[model samples]
Target chain A: MSRKRSRNIFIATCITPAIMLFALFMVVPTFEVFRMSLYNWGGLSGNKTFIGFNNFKVLWNDMRFIQSFQNSVLLIVLVAVLTIVVAIFFASVLTKEKVFATNFFRIVFYIPNILSVVIIAGIFSAVYNPRTGLLNSILGLLNLEQLQRQWLGNQDIVIYSLAGALVWQAIGYYMVMYMSGMASIPESYYEAASLEGAGKFKQFSAITLPLIWNNLRTTLTFYIISTINLSFLLVTAMTGGGPDGSTEVFLSYMYSQAYSNSTYGYGMAIGVVVFTFSFVLAAVVSRITKREVLEF
Target chain B: MKETKRINTDTLYKVFIYVALITLAITIIIPVAWVFMASIKENQEFYGNPWALPQGIHFENFREAFVEAGMGDYFLNSIIVTSLALVFLLVLALPAAYVLSRFEFVGSKFINGFIKAGLFINVSYITVPIFLMLLGWDQSLRQIFDSGFFLNNLSVLALIYAVTALPFTIFLLSSYFETLPSDFEEAANIDGAGYFRTMFSIMLPMAKPSIIIVILFNFLLFWNEYILALTLIPGDKKTLPVGLLNLLAADRAAVNYGPMYAGMVIVMLPTLILYIIVQKRLTQGMTVGGVKG
Candidate 1:
């Protein structure tokens, strides 16, 4: 029952497996990726030659890498903004007592959130199918045929199409988050505001939004991380960064370079850059939203 | 002014709100509906007008997708890997989470932060190094077992799945355990229950709901996972999602689009069923975890 003995027991019973497995699987491999990024390793069965920053310098000159980076940034911003707006709007309605079928609609909206990304990606690509697809067909049927564009093919619109699909899947989860945040807000405030002749929009801006500000902050962080990764998944499944890499995002391009081309060092270099890029973005987001804009 | 506002513009605004909500609902519903309706149609119907209703229910398309396209094998493999990974992830994450939540130590905060950092490091970012690592492990593993063993070389994928699921599961579970009262631990302590004994005997059962939530979330994620499986795990031994991608990528011209859609439906079936069963818990769990600091 000695204190030090108990401490040793705590360490033994608790920390070892978690730290050990994480360090072995996660930490070491992460370090190895960094080291390999410094070398010209050609993946498995390939030789390694340490070449400092060569891959990075080459990445700078690579237009595809730059384009993919642009695509990732675009997705991050678009998904965050669109999901927040849609979520807040939907959440406001659902949280009201008079909104009939609120729970039913909430669950209905969440249907896409619970489904797998691969399947959703398939569903979306089919929706964008050029000939008999839902989008183009609807456009054609409505006599708006001239406005229909090749949703996934026309390089100009492909990234936006991908972003739209992401926003569709993402909004429900955020909506629910906003719902939870709004649930915690006191009803008296809204009632008082209503009696003061405030309208629904006025009540939302004056009351619900400020109350859920912290929740929104957390949602923003979640958005930054998941949106970037989700972009990678969508591109891999739907386009494989295709139509001549028009839809390429950061991770898909890295995946192709490493897995497809077996340019291990180059791909690892991209990985390092992506890791750093995400880390900085997350830090910036957390910092920017750290100050509470409104206090209840 | 209040009476006038209530009579006209307020009603107009309420109608606008209702229309917007219904529009958003359609956007979410139509895609899944399209997939379901397409699954029942023959290729001719699908190709003719995908938006149109199916002429007759066709189970044959599902049969073709399950048998001819090798979806059954891929589905089984995905199940095995996702389940095995969840087990290992739980075994590894729970004890750490329990200790971090209940006990004090010098590096507890550091450890918590360290593991949470995994979220920032996307698996795609580190896939090359991890792939090489698995490939090396497979080399040694193959020598120990016969070369013809089906999943012998593929076991490393389950491990990777566990690692990817680790950060969030641990983060969620530790916080969940934190919300439980300390009296449970003191009660165990007074009864002479050791740390491991206390966790398995009490905390595991007590924290079961959160654990289930974490498991379901991770299961959905691993089941849907593709790029890692595509990169690290090679060949026809791949999981369901990558398998579907391969089917798509092979040749669209030669593909039977009907069966392909069926395969997509088959792939989506498990998650939809699980969501239906645990619909309430999924929303609550995700929202709670989502807003966690």
Candidate 2:
């Protein structure tokens, strides 16, 4: 056998199974989601009547769907901005060699990222429990009892509470990303900046910020994508989208529709919208961040 | 004179950094520590003084969590699903990544892109379709297995998890393989070693760091995955997260805060330990994968 033919055979043998599985599980089912969006297929029934774009029309008129989308968008913006700012701040501090107990602080901060969402929600639920929770207790200790209110139960504040929990959970991961990016920056820049008598904040703003712009962009993209797809566990345990559906992100809303309400077709329509939003947002961010590669 | 001035500034910077870090640590630790303390609090104490330290270590809560909540079975079920999924991911992704990274073949780029595209779609977006597919498969299994005993149908769920882990596995392994020098394979080829033997003996062993990262990340993901298990597994075969949710829901009208807290702690320990052990690798791997241009 020729060498080229044998290599082709090897590649074919290796790729076939994965290709088949991908088609069956991922590609086909994605198409199936699109197909189901066009039908009136409640989850349990064999009667799947064709109902063209009607599900999408229903979704457009659905106030809950609109609210869910708005909530998701708000979450994306809040989390993306807060996480980046916090991550960059910590990364800058930690990367300085003189920082004491840097390893200990890193591990402590990263613990939340490692935790399951269920556990995180459980802990935060205790912390924000209004009556006996830590936040209210602290408020009482500070003699601000009148200002203390139910954190998760208050409709106006539930989304902010959820966003706070998410930012706490995620800042560690993004900090690590920023730290890695900072590590890759040449030491000469810092030395030169110091030689030129650049103040700490000036060095950060003028030197480190632009140098790690790529990492910042990547982290922003990921944070946005993840927040948009925020799931049932966080929302359910923390607030159950509570105080009258105030905390319902798109994914949780879609989950409730499909599983809780058995509105499968409408849920599928929401799924399609989620897919488009994520894709377009990612594409735009990727394009915006596509700059000439920095060698250093 | 300049050196002394620089030293003073450096010392000041050190002081500032330590202050910031200590504050961040407190913010992170207090909530987790509160949860731990709350888990061991007696029912009365939990209600009366949720923030205070537990008066006594309530080992009974753990016992109750295991016995009343069926956490033992759920833990085993999770182990079975996560391990099987991890093994399947490694086996499938290893050779596929090797071939894609090393060989130039028709449709290879498209297949690589196909693997990556899975990561783009949120898992929830595909949940309805996956649930429908599994239901269909369960019906077929009943006809084939002929037992009407579908409780431990975690194998099918494991298959789905393997697919979910594939994108990361393939992406990481392929990149790692790309970094491997072709000299070793060439030397093995000169010695008449076949492709499989070369891969098993040379490439696989060399990719140990990548393999560990893949296993740890995939295990963490599959272990805590609640939505899929909730959808796929029958009521009796509940995994830990699902069981915790069920326990929470059982007394929906009343808050049985003790067992719910106990269940959360029990479910969290494995993941917490795994993270501590693999902290460095997990953080580094995520950064590289997430930030690479």
Candidate 3:
């Protein structure tokens, strides 16, 4: 065989398994998810009993599904905004030369991001535990008992409490991201802004925010996705979407229906909704955030 | 007078920034310390004083978590699944990345774009179908082997983990490969290196650092994975996160707070140690993927 012919064959040989595996696991199964969403099957077994979008229609009127969808969007917004704000604040500070132990602080901040969701949930639950939990105990110790309340059990505040945990876990990762973003900017921009008599706040809005706009937009997209999906693990761990379903999220709702409640078709329908909603949200956020890059 | 006022303002701003940063830092650090303290405390001590120092070392908590609460089993299960799955992912991604980056072929761009689209696929959205597919695998495996029930679950779990990881893996590594100079491949080809030999000897070795980064990304991913492991892997074969949940959920009846905390510690320690050790590389790998994506 010609060397070129053999080389082409070699490339094909090298490439086929990945394509096959990718198709089997991702492409084929994704198509399967959409197809199955139209049926009324219990699971893999028994008759599928085609219902043709009945599952989607039920999801439309499903209160639990609707509530969970709202909760997910709420989480996406809260986590995206809070994490970005906190991360930017810390990253901006750490990027400045005046900050002490930036390395130490950076590593410390990212620590929670590295830890398991289960562990973070454990810590959060302990803090939120009503009777002798840390938050209540600390409030009691400070003689501020009136401020203390059931953190996880109160339906009104439960999602917020869970969002707090998610933000806490996420800040470090986003901080590192913003840190990298800040690192790439020319230091001269900050110096010029300062020389122009722009104060700290003004310099941040002018120099820091504008330069980091690209990273911020990307981070916003990431935040939307993570807040929606990452909440699955955290919600499962901390509240299991509990205290009267206040914390129910798209994934947990789907999880319970598919596995716990054995309505795989309904669950798959919810999955399609979640998949569509988040992508649209991400696209909208990213588009709205798009701006002319301030090349330094 | 203006300069002095400016200096004072600068100091004030610094103080405000430091104070805000310090307070937030404490918020992150204290909870972890509390978990560690709780792990070593006696059950009553934990209930009585959540923040108190353990009266003694309580070396038994680790043992209790490992042996009694059976975190050891879950740890073993996670280690086996994550490591094997990472190996599987690398095996799939390396050559695919190599081909996509190097060879010109019809439909390659389409394939490459398809892989990129997979990045946006939230695996949870498709969990129902994926779960059913695993059930199908189980049925087929049982009928064929007439035994080895957990085999399909384990195999399917590994595949799922690898597949979920593929988009990022291929994207990152293909970019890495694209950045490489053609000199090495050209040199090997001129030296009469066969195709497989050239890829294995020259290209693969050169891609080592990128490969390591891919492995770290997938390793961290599979280690902390919860949802799939929760759905697919059954009772005793639960991965660490899922197993920790099971342990904590059952702890109400068990009332074994010390061991429960220890299990939490156990679940977190590997990734913690890993982050500390390869702190730079871990952050770089994850951020590279993040920033690039």
State the iRMSD of every prediction, in order shown.
2.7, 2.7, 2.1
Over A48-90, each residue of candidate 2 has an lDDT whose tens digit, in order, gives 8899999999998999989888888888888888888888899
Model 3 lDDT on a 0 to 1 scale: 0.83
Off by over 4 Å in 1: A1-7, A293-295, B1-5, B139-154, B291-293
- DockQ of candidate 1, scored on C-alphas against the true complex (2 decimals): 0.59
Which residue pairs show collisions in model 3?
none
Worst 10 residues of 3 chain A by lDDT: A39-48
DockQ of each candidate relative to the true complex: 0.59, 0.57, 0.67
Candidate 1 lDDT score relative to the true structure: 0.81
Between prediction 2 and prediction 3, the one with superior lDDT is 3
After superposing candidate 3, which stretches have Cα over 4 Å from the reference?
A: B148-152, B291-293
Write candidate 2's Cα lDDT for B138-210 as tens digits: 6777788865433347877787788876777788888989998899999999998877788789989998988
Candidate 3 on A1-296: residue-level lDDT in tens? 89888978888888888888788878887898788788787844546779998898888888998899899888888988888888899988898758887788888888987777788889988888998688899899999999898999899888888899989989888888888888888888888888898878898888889988998888887887888777987888878888788899998998888778887777778888888887888898888889999887
| Top of the candidates by lDDT | 3
Chain A TM-score of model 1 comes to 0.93
Residue pairs with colliding backbones in model 1 are none
Compute the interface RMSD for candidate 1: 2.7
Report how far off residue B23 is in candidate 2 (Å). 2.2
Candidate 3 has a TM-score of 0.96
Q: How many clashes show up in model 1?
A: 0
Please list the Cα RMSD from the true structure of every candidate, rounded to 1 decimal place: 2.6, 2.8, 1.8
Q: What tens-digit string does per-residue lDDT give for candidate 1 at A169-239?
A: 88888888889889878888988998998977788888887788888887777887787778887887888
